[model samples]
Target: MPLPKAQTLFGYSPEAPELSKAEVSRRFDELMATIDSLPTRHVGASEVAQAFGEGRGIDFGARPGNAFEALTKALDGPDIAKAMSSDALASVTSALEALKAEQPDLMKDITPSSPIGTGLVAYDLEAPAKMLTPRPTPLRNRLPRKKGIGLSHQFKVISGFTGTATGGVANIHPGIGDTTQTNFAPSGASNALYYARGPKISYAGYDKTVAYSQFSVSDAVTWSAQYAGQGYQDVRQLSRTSLLYSSMLLEERMLLMGRGTSGRGFLGAVAAPTGVALTARTAAGSEVALSGFTTNVYVKVTSDAGDFGQSVLSTAANVGVTAGQVVDVTCVLPAGATGVRVYVSTGASDPGDASRWYAGRVGYNTFTLQGALPTSGVAASTITADTTAYTNGYDGILPICTGPDSGYVNRLNAVLSNTNPGSEWQTAFAALYDAVKADPDRTLLNGSDRKQLSDALKTNSSSNYRMTITQDQLTGVTLGDVVNTIINEVTGKGVAVEVHPWMPQGNAPIISDTLPLPDSEVSDVWSVFNVQDLLGVDWPVTQFAFESSSYWMGALLCYAPAWNGAITGIKKA
Candidate 1:
């Protein structure tokens, strides 16, 4: 029966053999090596041939002759011939054609030359190596040796006042009577005695001395006179005068103190000068005495007596005073005294005794001296202008124009800087057109004017403006869209778009030994074309497929010799 089929003979079968572990392992290794060595273009063909060979002891070599013949015979063999009908043959032929057609154009340009046998080597073989020259020493030193110095200063001044006042007399006098009679005779001698001296005869004056003697004439007369005076005149008068004067003399003393102390202890507190003590005796048998008042007051004493002397005592009544209490003695500076001194007296009287007082304390006024003395090094100097130090340093430069001018200058500069040059005319025109389209401002430019403007911008020179045009023009298009557009535009021009996704920008990946079809290209094609249409024989194949095919073919060519090397035990060329 047609020489039993290989599967039927010697226990061989058409169904894939249940290979032993060792056999399977060996077969898999051989297949892998074969696959690795062949060109990618033959990958499908080789696979087909291998399936046939494994099933029917056929051999497919690197050259198509033996492999193709073996494959043809295996298909037509008595046991398998019926399987290889006209339809199967046609399908295989079509697949082969499709695979061949997918080969990249770049592959045809490659010309491998034998370096050992050919005399047409492009590189020089006997050229001597040139010795590298040493770099010359630097011409000048640029390191900084010393740093510069900077210093600043400032000053401040403060001044003001405090004082107190007390005690005056309340005087009273009798009212004048309407009667003018000097004397009157008495009915009783005792009553006459009360009117003795004839009612004091003269009514010219109500003097205390005159009225006293006339009142001693009788206790009844004296008592009546006192009652009449009770509701009469009341007057207040100063019983004692005390003055405290601070003049140029006192200020001079304070300034001297300040200069001696530096700024450390510039402030001083002065207590009131001495004054007489007031004592009162009560029925409780205890003595209540009032000594001098104590208050913490301050002043800015300076050499400028003009300003210092103008200082007056501030009111201290609100600070330290009681209802029954009184400032019996006022603080004063003696007329002949040279420096500042405090004096005191008793009973609101001026003692005129300069020795009765002493200087309790002295103070230096920092406020007055602050203005006169130079500022300390620690003070901060006010900055009035930008400096060169800011230009090269991390500190930002202070703009020359601050407040109002900054905004105006910035806007003006921006507008001026954006003006298109002649070379960037096209880019500028495109940008303006885009802007107008987005927000058509007829008031800004009429249709005719816009066209003219566009024409002018088209001739302008500016890379920045050109880039703007590109972005604006491509608005929402994806990378795939760009490829499609390029392909469409370049089609029918004999030159097809060589889209090498894995290629470096300048050197196309089409020439690479291993190129992969970009997902973007596949996605883009799928978007516009049906999968069935793409697989159809007549549909145009993509550049990505072509490049990937060429890459695989190149890889196969390079490794073909390696396969022979493995079979023959020779080193690959």
Candidate 2:
């Protein structure tokens, strides 16, 4: 049937003007659909997988041959009964035919050996560790101090009579010539008039002393957790602060020694005289017998007097070599044979020296560290270290000397041989007191001494020593006995006494442990300047970080020597 006439608005018959437009539009749409059907761009395997997962349609540029999906579909269909590969089908059918042709014998079952018995394999992990106990740090907290900050310091004082005196004996004499003053053999050339003078102005000086400590680390070392518990010094867990603390102790020790660097305010002192032999050596066959040391360990044998010191290497799972091995010691020559030191080591190896072996602690040989043989078999190297005696206790403090004519009248100094300690202590005190009595600076002066003095006092002192008035005059005098007697006498006069561990030890048995000094702030006796307090900072790297800290300070005895006096050679043997 003939279609209705097309209108320009919508129909497409052919006579209307709009018919052409509408036909063109329809043709454009068909062209677009054809273009869309053609492959537009390449899609990757991932895109294919993604599309499949999304259940979306995909053309894949027309049909692809022998695809896995087609094979899979065919296998699932009725074609499953047919062999897929010629070899696989032939082998399967032949094997089936043979099975039907003849039955084969079966073999026995086999099993693998596993699930190891309880003690068969050692699966236990060994954790390596050693106990560390720090040695005593003796100097830091002991010294007496007047804590403050300032520039160079000094103590103001008055010493000798400063100016000439007047009004003693008149130069004009009323002699035999009565009223004729010149006639009394008053050649007047010998009239000497003495007058009292005002106190002399004096000052003591002190300079700063710097004390410091430092440590450093690398990143890898601190970060590795695997190394946490396996070594002698577990540096991973803690900073080795022994060095820093040691330095601090050393500074205090030096100050009290007053032996080294007299010019730098008399710091770093104390040296015993050269002994007959500072060291002793023995050939093999002399090492003492030991049993507790099981193999590698570090050991140190120090003479009780610290006159000699040494360390030895060791092997594992074994104690000392009972019969052979050279043993050398660096201490005062052993007299006859009496070991003076406590030979022991904290670990198997020397923490400060890498060359030394890991010798376990000494005294380990003793079972239970008691009974008959416990301490009986110490190393032959242990021997008595005798000390040389100084002439007197005063000698310990006199590093320098002054002349009577030097106008110092020794007033700037005090000298007294410890002749009769019981009596001389009083004399020494008197000399120091008299020297500064006029200066009026005695108020702040206190006294300090080393542990030796305290030990000496404790050793000799008795209940009677504490009781001065009721004590028997015939009682034996001990170092402590004499020292306390003197200190008690001095303290009653308003002076304070204290223990200073850094004081030089006595060279002589009687006086070695006695550097008791009447200390004072005379001008801040040790005017210390803190250039810097301990400052800790972090230095980080790509792998780890390091913690570093440092401290700086300086101390000096204010120059007023007269403000304080030390009894260097006190003896109460």
Q: All predictions: root-mean-square deviation over Cα?
A: 52.1, 23.3
lDDT of 1 by residue, 300-353 (tens): 111111111212222221123222233222223211111221222222332222
lDDT of model 1 at residue 423? Answer: 19
For residue 107, model 1's alpha carbon misses the true position, in angstroms, by 9.9
List model 2 lDDT by residue over 20-125, tens digit each.
5555455345434544554447888888987778767574443323333332343343333342333322332333334333432111112232223353455555
lDDT of the candidates, in the order given = 0.22, 0.31
Model 1, position 324, has a per-residue lDDT of 29
lDDT of 2 at 391: 16
